[model samples]
Structure formats: C-alpha cells, structure tokens
Target: DVKRGKWEAPELLKEAKSFINKHKDSNTKIGKLRYMAVEDKASGTGLIQSISKQTTLPIRAIQRSTDKLSRTMDVILYVEERRVWLPANAPWLLNYIEEIEGLTADWTHDHDDQWDPTIDAINDSLAKKPTVFD
Candidate 1:
C-alpha cells in the first residue's frame, strides 16, 4: 500500500479519532498506546505529534532499544508457564496464532513485524511477576 499511497497525518488523525470513539462508545477501556518512537534519522515525529494532539489519548512514544530476537525469546518462559492468554473465539485468533507460530530466530523471517507489538503488550500488560493468588 505504500507504493499505491500512504495515509497522511489528517487521515490518520481521523481514523484514530473514529477508532477511539468506537471504543469509548462501547465502554471499552484502552490503556496508553505505545507508538514506536521514530529514530532520529527517520521522518515520523510530525505524524505522531499530530495524532497525539487530535486524539488527546495517552500515547507513549517509546523507542525499542533491545533486539527483536532477544525480546521474542524473553516471552517464551511466560508462554510455557501459562502466563500468556488469548481471548477465545476472537476473529483474529487464527491469524495471530499463525503469526506467533511462524516466528523464528531467523532475522530474515517476516513474522517479527506482526509480533513486535504483541510481545510488547505481553511484557507490559500480562507477563507480570507472580502474586500469591496467581
């Protein structure tokens, strides 16, 4: 789609606003969104800033410092220990599982792109240290 055309800031803002509104109307609570911080050599700060202003949502622009393979490897123990859970019957479940299953240590593999944020979510939201009840 990049070759066809890419979304401009205004379009991105509109889509973000609509999506947030839908979640709000449905009583869904979304936590802070983590936007991968663009590197100094890249050109996306303006877009992220614009969307932040338009949505007024808690958006954390974070730079991923660790290597993808390392981050991917860290979650394995959590999965083996049953700390990661997926919603049953979710429409995206199959594709998500497929992507997870397709992940490999090979740097050339394409599945990492689909799994980066997912691993982030697992690390940030789900895979916490055990409590007594847990």
Candidate 2:
C-alpha cells in the first residue's frame, strides 16, 4: 500500500452529530401514572399525599413516580388567584380530566398569587351565617 489505506479522511476525521430534540416514541408507565395522580384534581403541592391516598401506595413509591413524571412535565399543577391550573393540551384530554376524573384546571397553585385557604373558610362562615333560602 502507498499510504496504508485502512481508513479514509472523511470517515476518520469527521465527527458524528447527535440530535436529541426528538422525544421518545411514547409516554412511559411512570409518566402516565404521574398524569393520573393529578387527574383527580388533587392539589399541586399535595400531589404526593393525594396520590398516596388515591393509589394506596407508599410515599416513597409515589415519590419515585412523581420524579419520573416531573422529568416529562415540569409544571404538573399549580394554584393562583384562588383558582387551580391543569395540564391539558388536547380537547379530549381536557374533557377526560373533567368528565372522567371530575377534575378542573387548577394549575395556578405555584403562581405568585398563591391560593389562600382562609378565603374559603370566610366563605364557609358567610354561607352558614343565614341564607335567605334557609
């Protein structure tokens, strides 16, 4: 051989490129479980507790599931302005969460204007004071 022709310049010198923009083919089991955790209109902060109660799973196990889901969706749920925010990209998903899960969009739990439980207490007191219907 004139120059030891074992490799070519293009093959040996070129560096391979990686494209990571594309996500996985489908959602993982843990991801789906995490979505369902919030599907019951559970509180954003109390997601772990709610999921634990609903699924009867230990906190550690639920935490593992939550970890998996957080990787996919950062803002799982939120509350703000005395309202909750929900995760819904498709009409079907929104309806499913509403009708099947009996949950509404309550994603504002982590907003600057946090929901105040005291307001609900005040409303409750007012409600019990004396209603014209009563």
Candidate 3:
C-alpha cells in the first residue's frame, strides 16, 4: 500500500505548495503552515503553545526560527496537514515545511482544526480589505 500510494504523497505536496503560492499574503496559509510545523511533534505536539510549555524556547524564538527558515528554504512543512509547499522561488523552504508536516503527522491522526486566535485576527483584518489577495 505504501508503494501504491507513494504518488499520492508527492501529489498532495505539489497541491499544497501551489495553494500556498497562489495566495500571496494569505493569512490562513501562513498561520496554518507555521502552526502545523511548530505544533506537530512526537514527544510534544509541535504547536507553539506546546513548545512554549515544554521547552525554554520562547514563542518568539520559535516564530523567528520558522520565519528565518521559510525565508532561506525552498519548502515549508505543514506537518499537521500532512503536506509540504514549495515557496515558489526558494526550494529550500519546501523541505522545511515538509519536515514540520511529517513530524506533526507522526504524532497523531486527528487533523481536527483547533481554534486559532491569530486566524481570527487575520480574518478580521482581511475582512477590511477589498479582497483577501488584494
């Protein structure tokens, strides 16, 4: 089954990357991917809050690490969503997102959407715009 479904993984990753690249300044894409990477972990959920609780790494440090990696890498891993996105130009970021997603998926199967305060703020800000992309 793993071999037969092998193509599915790449396809999913391609789709996820396309989705992320298509929407410039998409808060959902940014938040979801970052959240998944940081929150989805084995010993601890890779979530920002979880990371903050379990380690001395400050939330800002986690955020900065993710941001710096995204800026320098080709792919960004959204582990919670079990997908990876290619950052249009930066191929390095693609693997980063994939790593995060892999770590997140390994920890659990329940991909339920959790309440995100950041998403709410982003949504509110987006609502004021003529369009989310614009």
Candidate 4:
C-alpha cells in the first residue's frame, strides 16, 4: 500500500532512541502504570476522548512508536506484483509471513469472480458515467 506521508528516517531513529532511554528503567512508578488499562475505564473515557480530539500528538506519537519498534524496516505492500515483501534484516518479518500469506489467499478467493468483465455491462456502465476514474 502507498503510504500517505513521507518517512523521516533520522527523526524516527532519534525518537526511537529517546523512547528506549526513557523506558529503559522499568522500575519507575510511571513506567509501571498501565496507561492503556487506565484509559479503557469509564473515568478515563472522557479524558481519552478529549485528548484524542484536542491534539494530533497521539497519532504522531503512535507513528513514532511504531517506527521505533520496527527499527530499520519499512512496511510495504506492492500492489502491481500482488506481493508483500519485508526486509530480511527485519526479524519480525518471519513472525508475520504466515499471516500475510493467509491474508493474500483469503483476498484472492473473495475477489476472484470480480476479475471477469462483460462487454455489454461494461459499455452500459460506461455510458452512464462521464468518467470512471473521477
């Protein structure tokens, strides 16, 4: 899949390093607190909702966190080749290959019938629309 935003490798690396440094000490009270569990409760609902609405920080922070976790890898889905390729350097790829293969198989089974086109139906549909891509 085409990523909508640009990838900044340096910034991502810096953010990853910072995250590691900040979280390296697991004994801290703040680190021990499960933010996700807390955020799921009724009391935290309003706080979570308000935070989500008020700032772009959450999405940016998540993207940064994902970038950090992945380290050197880039996530890519090649549409033309109908293949999902992951770098050999990325060890996590091994863990997900089976899942990715299953997804491709499922997608092909679901969409197989849609590939055949009828000329009469195509022409009729074309006549109704000024431009198909639009």
- Return the TM-score for candidate 1, rounded to 2 decimals: 0.69
Candidate 2 versus the native: TM-score? 0.16
RMSD of each: 5.9, 22.9, 16.4, 18.4
lDDT preference between candidates 1 and 2, better one: 1
Ranking by lDDT: 1, 3, 4, 2
Least well predicted 10-residue stretch by lDDT in candidate 2: 14-23
Each prediction's whole-model lDDT (CA):
0.59, 0.28, 0.34, 0.32
Model 1: residues with Cα > 4 Å off, grouped in runs = 1-10, 25-44, 127-134
Which segments of candidate 4 are over 4 A away from where they belong? 1-77, 80-85, 104-134
Model 3 CA RMSD to the hidden true structure, in angstroms: 16.4
Give me the candidate number with maximum TM-score.
1
Estimated TM-score for each candidate: 0.69, 0.16, 0.20, 0.24
Cα lDDT tens digits, model 4, 55-115, are 3334221112232113212222122243423456555455444433343422443222111
Task: Compose the digit string of candidate 1's lDDT tens values, residues 14-102.
Answer: 65556656554453333333333222213346656665676655555546778877877788787878787777766777877887788
- Provide the global lDDT of candidate 4 against the true structure: 0.32
